[model samples]
Target: MTRIVVVTGGTSGIGRAIAERFAADQAEVFVTGRHADTVELTAKELGVHGVVCDATAPGQVSSLAARLERVDVLVNAAGGLPETASGDVAPLNALLAQWHSSLAQNLLTAVLTTAAVQDRLTSGSSVISIGSIGAERRGGSYGAAKAALAAWNASLSAELAPRGVTCNVISAGYIADTNFFRGQMSDERQRTLVEETHNKRPGTVDDIAQTTCFLASPGARHITGQAIHVNGGAFTTR
Candidate 1:
């Protein structure tokens, strides 16, 4: 039987790459995005199903859950660096907005999406959430939310393990050729990030995508409730 896989925020970047990887394996892949045009275009280009869903919104997320009968893999990739409004006069209000957006996108999206679709996951299913190395350092609001995601994954794994579901977090480092930096990355900053890695190179979308595939595979059944670092030694477990 073809495995059913769902990837949120799958319009571009790491999410799109992961979706494409699974599609190549002929899995029944579902890629989701907030924009209709992008979702339709990506789904067509990849020959996979597309869902228009704002993963942070509970109503839309539940609607997404309703579309699936069974889920073999759920990839919570619907998050990014918070783009807070900058014109606010009040510093605290702006700060609150940034943090709230960060948590809702990075943390709650995964929580809500998983909660809504968890029952559809049967034995041997996998739940993968995209995390960040920033969670280990000066990630600011984004890092804090990712840290919370890791924490939540621990508890989620405990609850789901008995049911034969495995949950894990992929803590990625500075990956290249993605919109993640949002045009704010300088050449010097990019170079510095590359240099920090032991391999002296930037991580690629394929790098993370491949790891995602491996985790969802049968060989990874024992790997759960852990943050698997894929940063080319940039962030070591030690």
Candidate 2:
């Protein structure tokens, strides 16, 4: 049977890679992006359906859900670092805006999207949320939100596990390619990030994409409520 998959923020970067992986498997993939033009272009280029929707907006998320009748895999791949989270602002306002934006983008995006599509998730479906290594260190507001996401996923897994639906978080490390850094990442910083990894290399989008594909497969049915790290040994858990 052809699986119906929904990937939010699927226009570029890791989200787009996940969408492509599922599409390659012949899944009926529907990708969402905030921009109509990019969504249309990505859908066309990827041979998958596309919807222009902002996962953080209730109305848009509702509309996106209304378009789906059944979902076998719901990949909450939205979320990103905002300049306000790391840029110059009044110290007090910066603190508030930074946290608020981080939570809304990283944690709330997954929460709202999952809530909106919960009813449509199939019995053996998989719900994957993209997490970050920043959550473990130096993440600041973004990290805190991602950490919260892992906690939320734990609760989500408990609820869905009984229904044969698996919920998990993928904690990704420093990944190259895509506009994630927005070109502000200095070469020195990039080298330092790579050196921190045991493999002395940055992760590729395909790394996360492949892991997501496996988690969505039947083989991963028993693997729920876990934060699987994919940062090339940058961080280790005992």
Each model's lDDT:
0.96, 0.94
Model 1, 1-238: lDDT tens digits are 9999999999999999999999999999999999999999999999999999999889999999999999999999999999777774598888889999999999999999999999999999999999999999999999999999999999999999999999999999999999998988999999989988999999999998999999999999999999999898998988
Candidate 2 lDDT at 138 equals 93
Question: Pairing residues by index, what is the TM-score of model 1?
Answer: 0.99
What are the models' TM-scores?
0.99, 0.97
Error of 1 at 163 (Å): 0.7
lDDT of 1 at 150: 99
Taking all chains together, the TM-score of candidate 2 against the true structure is: 0.97
In terms of TM-score, the best-performing candidate is 1
lDDT agreement of model 1 with the native: 0.96
Identify the runs in model 1 with alpha carbons over 4 angstroms from their true place.
Answer: none
lDDT of 1 at 167: 98
Q: Write the per-residue lDDT of candidate 2 for residues 1-238, one digit (tens) a residue.
A: 8999999999999999999999999999999989999999999999999999988899999999999999999999999995574656679988788788889999999999999999999789999999999999999889999999999999999998999899999999999997988889999999999999999989999999999999999899999999999999999996
After the best TM-score superposition of candidate 1, give how far the Cα of residue 19 lies from its true spot, in angstroms. Answer: 0.2
lDDT at 159, model 2: 93
**Best candidate, lDDT:** 1
